[model samples]
Target: MAGGSFALPKPRPSGPPYFSRNQVANVLHQVAVLLELQGANVFRVRSYQNASRLLGSLSEDLGELVASGEIFNMKGIGKGLGSALTQAITEGRWPDDWIDLHTNTPPGLIEMLGIPGLGPKRIKLMADELGVDSVASLKEAALNNQIAPMKGFGAKSQQRMLDGIELLSRFRARRRLDIGLRYGEAFQRKIAAIDGVHRATLAGSARRRKDTIGDLDVVVAVDEADHETVANAILNLSGIADVKGAGDSKISLILDTTIFDESFTVGHIDPNVLDAIGGDDYEQLEAGGTIDAQVRLVPPHVEPFTLAYFTGSKEHNIAVRQRAIDRGLRLNEFGLIPETKAGDLKGMEAAVHSLGAADEAAIYAHLGLAYVPPELREDMGEVLAAETGSLPSLIETSHIKGSLHNHTTLSDGEASLELMADTARKMGWNWLGIADHSPTLKIANGASAEDLLEQGRTIQQYNAEWAEQGVDFRLFHGVESDILEGGKLDHPDDVLAELDYVVASVHAMTKWRGRDEHDNTEELLKVIDHPATTVLGHPTGRILQGREGYEVDLYAVLEHMAEHNEEGRLKAIELNASPYRLDLDWRLCKHAKGLGVPVAINPDAHSIRGLSDIAYGVMTARKGWIEPNDTLNALSGADLAKRLVR
Candidate 1:
């Protein structure tokens, strides 16, 4: 559709692209669920579930696979499911004969499965007994005592159903930060390219780089007269699935996205695309997720005003407004102006005399404050810091010297060690730390001691060869040693001591599973006290939307490390750069820095391409006011070695 386009002759698609790999998988999954609800054959239902997962884990594009006639030979694809995937991709639905089956159940009934104590049998009972078809109806029945009188339904079960609804409601409200940005930026760019648009910038928590975002706010500037043109331009964008409203000044819409064209190209392979297909931390950009989007257009003079106003933590804006009031001025989305009584002024936009409003820095200057970065706009003493000229120079991506928590093909990573090292070298770094997982975490195919020693020899040879070539890049070997439930390390101290650094982490049984938060806290304390443990990997063991962090007193853990840092034990906490798991979240980074604890903005990358996530980590660290001095990886290899305990 751009420079050139060629149609693939075989596997002719009957329609334009509609379903992404995720959508195809979801359709199969939904079919399986609906069949089970209706009591279909167990084996038949299980087959659909298996195919859904197989598709979810695929690297190849489903449409292209069908187009290439490769679906028939693919593993885990039986004839029934193969036909269904291709049908869903091209036709956007299952076969005509199956339409009734797909639509037989009310869509909301599937959501009931998410409630912890509810299953198909319970749901079927509820449907039959209460005539419930949606969460709303189910809630009504529970509240009305309709289900409590039925068999196997009592006060506790009704209470659980109510609790599950509350939890799902919260999760439904906002998206994790990276997820929103991944989808928002694409439309932001597309809208800014429209004819009447002069500029486009994402505001709200996205611009401020918060850990999670409620919605994306985009503000643009255009000629005063081009407002409608820009608004309609936003309405027509491909992924703008639903328009909530539209106006001259602003428009609200729902954005549903799959992997954008910029992120995925079927049948096209590149050497640099680690995690190119499916690996940890990699998914379709948006993965066909949905988020709320707001687009607004303003006059050039009011561009900075609206941007700052919209890109605010409510409290941050309140602080700025109060400061303006004290100085005989007022601020709003329109612009900054002389103080006006309600009766004397039409609005903030109608001011006759203006202080400057063309840029955020100018607005801050007029208010007698330094330009605050979006990351620091949390109103967390930033206003006073701005007043006293004591604001910090937040760390940037360039400040990171090299990453310390990286993975390779040796353990659940997409790229091989050679590939990962080559990528690190290309980034102009002096060294790269490779910390594969321990053997006990067999799900990642963790490395044994023999494998570690063999990898060490391979690294030494590569270093020797690269040295002769004058590349000057060195490799450091280590393991992401698992911290078991009891706080003991998966590897022996001897094995840990053989490496450059041991990144101790809790990968499984992290939740407050029948144990006190104090138990988890003490567990981490013991692990951190291990002489061989150098950094804590994802101190929280959180996977963003998928899993909450384990229960533990993180503050106590950070305090413990602060006291131990001088001893060269547990030198840093990982700012895991994986979009899904930016653990040791930026909010806590500042506290760690204050405690004299260092951090490593490690990509926790599974492949070379995944290394780019370091940029996100750097931004997150900035949000916590972390500086170069607060990061261990900001050091040269030699200095880093000196900083570590022998």
Candidate 2:
């Protein structure tokens, strides 16, 4: 599992595709480790360690910035570490000393560090003192209760380790839903191209729009005579690693992603860094995840019913079948038939029945239920909602008219104001809100007073041009002001009031490591109380796999915001669209909706590519039961402009 051809691209330090922030940060971190291993000066080690963290947290590309000769002006990264990064750029590897020190470390010991929630120091303790060198060994120790006897890792830590290992089994089997969607879409086209194929589409959790996906289920309908030909052709496709099953109706293969899977770009400091960067998680999952496509030869009159039946969530199928029984009809993948005992219909993926054709609505009509969208097919009261007439009219991608709480080169963003606006206009947006960092987050290049004023003037000129061109597109000047340790905005009241919008966010204020919980929630409440505060950006400030959200009474903060919505104070809660920081998380967004607060699905985009993350945010929003009216950016340009000033 450890050995493979490491054809890692030689990172170009100055450009678009440098090694990830995490990879570079990990190098710095490893330098500190190597220095420690060599008994180097404490200050020297601390400097590297600090620089590692600084680069890890950076929103801007440290490589590009450093390559641009800006690292000298930056705080935290001193000359020594900066030189190391510079050397790494040209050498195409970490310093030789780091490699030598890293090689001397015990084999399989790094795997122990892969355990989430456990740092290297602790892993070393286990490796040196307890002889736990691998995950398997660690899990065995935990299961045998041997790990419970350790000094720091007691019974609780032992149990947690065991649970994490169990979770790892599941996590390693599934793909992030976004990745699955890509694979699913690519395969759909390939399957549809099988001659005589009528239709091909994804099923299972991918169809249900789950955040993570297990093995994919694809369903195809074709002519009865073409089933063999279609199945044979798919079995012979290039990149089909192995054929697991080849039946008249089903063709199962392990499609190697090597054909279509791009090198998934990754950032460092992620909890899943080893799994993603090492390509272990990708290999482990795809090696087991099978693509099963069911080709049912059905009449044109019966394809829709077949697709609906095959594209089922098991719970949904059970509910629908129960409904069919109530109506004296039987629902199965085969089609609708007369009511029959379960024993009579066993072992049949296909069956012939009465009173059913292709369309789902017609079948649902027979069962006295409404057609449920595939994404809502989970048994989350959708069936009952269908029975009644109250299904939520979910928000669509088209409903979003603008983006808010965005960043540009004025702050840490890689793109400029002109570029951000161009990207927004291309996406059919009527307006955009640029809430660059206020002067507190030195790490994110928070704008100074002069910088904000200059950006404001630039936005003014852009607006004038927009008016001149008779274009609806407009830009709202805003600031993502930091909330200081207490409750004050990073920028002055006079400064914040000058902007069209304000986004007060907790940067250093939240004691994410658990120093203060009650106070942190109170700090957020006070920020929300500010009359100019527009949206609470990433309310929890969590990186999903990397870091837990800062401790705060989220429900209490949301309730407080709801009570203070009179003058549109804390007007909207942001569903920040970064893959790592999907905060306020969907669960909390649902609560916000219940509290009558609208959610804004902001990409929190620092670059143009970041704008595409809106889809992920929208998916999270849909999961939160947010509708167009429940979202703030659904407002048009003029309306949003008016609201921001109000």
Candidate 3:
């Protein structure tokens, strides 16, 4: 009452304005709380909290205000808060207060919050009470009999914590594409065995072509009446850890535990248990035992495949769907269906097809479209080409005539060259190339020029012996040579010129600091254009987590190779099937195919077990829409030799 002239603080902006500002301010306040909880400076913490509240009350987006230079007019927004908001919007970074708060928080704790039972309070309690700060420390303490003895932790709680840690570890180190497919296939098999489940297929990320998946999603189609029973049957499966959520038609559960647990436990569970838990859990739970569940179920007639079909990339599906629509027809997860006389088919494949379409081809023909290959389903203009009857013939496993790019004990490989050759022959390959590393890579026992010549003589003698025995397979001398800095091949040009084939690779240059500046793409293009270089080995020198390799512009390299046909424009890229580094990433394979560049789907096999990796490569190639004609290995040994020679 000093002057009795208090302005009542501008009456704090009425209605939604105050509410909206308060909400935003509340979020910012939460950030302050998090920072304070992490022990940030009290004064700085208050500033963020105050700013958050002030910004939330504003009617317009903070970014828009900042852009229009109207932020200064907003109450409580001074130069400091304004600058912070601008930084957050433009750089996708937190304010200085946030950065300071985060700096004090233990690393990986943010990710640890994702675990089912852990929360901020509990995490803080663990940190304060038991000196547990990291996932590794928590795991160590749990295993060492420290956590269960803590104030609120019980034996069951400790076990759950251990399970959570194990799950997190497995989830962190998951293998990509194949893991999803295998889990989906296994789940499909289980669902198929159930009596009332007329059809079952995997959907979601597995369908979308994501390399690694967090969960497996299977959608089953049954008779409308049988949905509840089928759902119950799935929930009752042996290895189910918990029924996360369920409805009359849909049920979500976590499957078996991690591989570490699987190997130790009886009746080892499927490795994809984490993926079975999904975002639909809460929805399914809320739906409960109502007809609303029926909304999620695919109809019996085409549900199984349709569920699988729809679970993939929506972008990919849209492309496929648009293709169907353009042809005066409709397509869905079920199958291609004719358009209704009334214009659209209500997304029902059976009803639309029953109106008198003969087959898949016939359905496409009716739409004035040519048959589209399943492998080339990734929209990428394939549908347009198919309509014009210009779709490329993608490579198939059968198109591969010979196995090349194998290693032996002469390097870091497990088997002898002869053993690898015998296995290649047994696999029905017409030829096999031994492309062990060169001398500089000490870890692999890479051969010197003299050693390579001796190895060549041994291979020649082995081929001579096999030829005398009338064996159909021929052995070609090759080397997986390291591409050194300055675009130097591992061996001198003369030695490389002597080999039947040269798989030029960036092994040591994987960690070269000047990757972008050194022009790895141009360097690679130069190698591919080299007269002696036959195949570009693992175009991306990646090793999973170990390194990402040079950011060589693959599209540019592919385009360059496409343009330089006279100097052997038909450069072959390796589909290195080392599970960790599925190099020449499948995404790039499509670009290569589009440019008419050749690919070599090599297992890059180091042993008999490694040879099986070809299946993985085949699937990867299929995903990229690579056809047999685009791969050099699809050629017969004589034809392949002829091409390599030139």
The best candidate by TM-score is 1
For model 1, the superposed segments whose C-alpha errors exceed 4 Å read 1-172, 262-288, 340-343, 510-512, 568-570
Off by over 4 Å in 2: 1-171, 261-306, 309-312, 340-343, 347-350, 507-510, 515-519, 566-570, 584-586
TM-score of each predicted structure versus truth: 0.71, 0.67, 0.66
Candidate order, lDDT descending? 1, 2, 3
lDDT for residue 386 in candidate 2, whole number 0-100: 92
| Candidate 1 lDDT tens digits, 464-521 | 8877998767887788888886678877777677777888877665344445566778
Lowest lDDT block of 10, candidate 1: 1-10
**Candidate 3 similarity to native, TM-score:** 0.66
For residues 41-64, what per-residue lDDT tens digits would candidate 2 score against the true structure? 878888888787667545465557
Overlapping backbone residue pairs in candidate 1 total 1
Highest lDDT: which candidate? 1
Candidate 2 positional error at 269, Å: 11
lDDT on C-alpha atoms for all candidate structures: 0.75, 0.70, 0.63
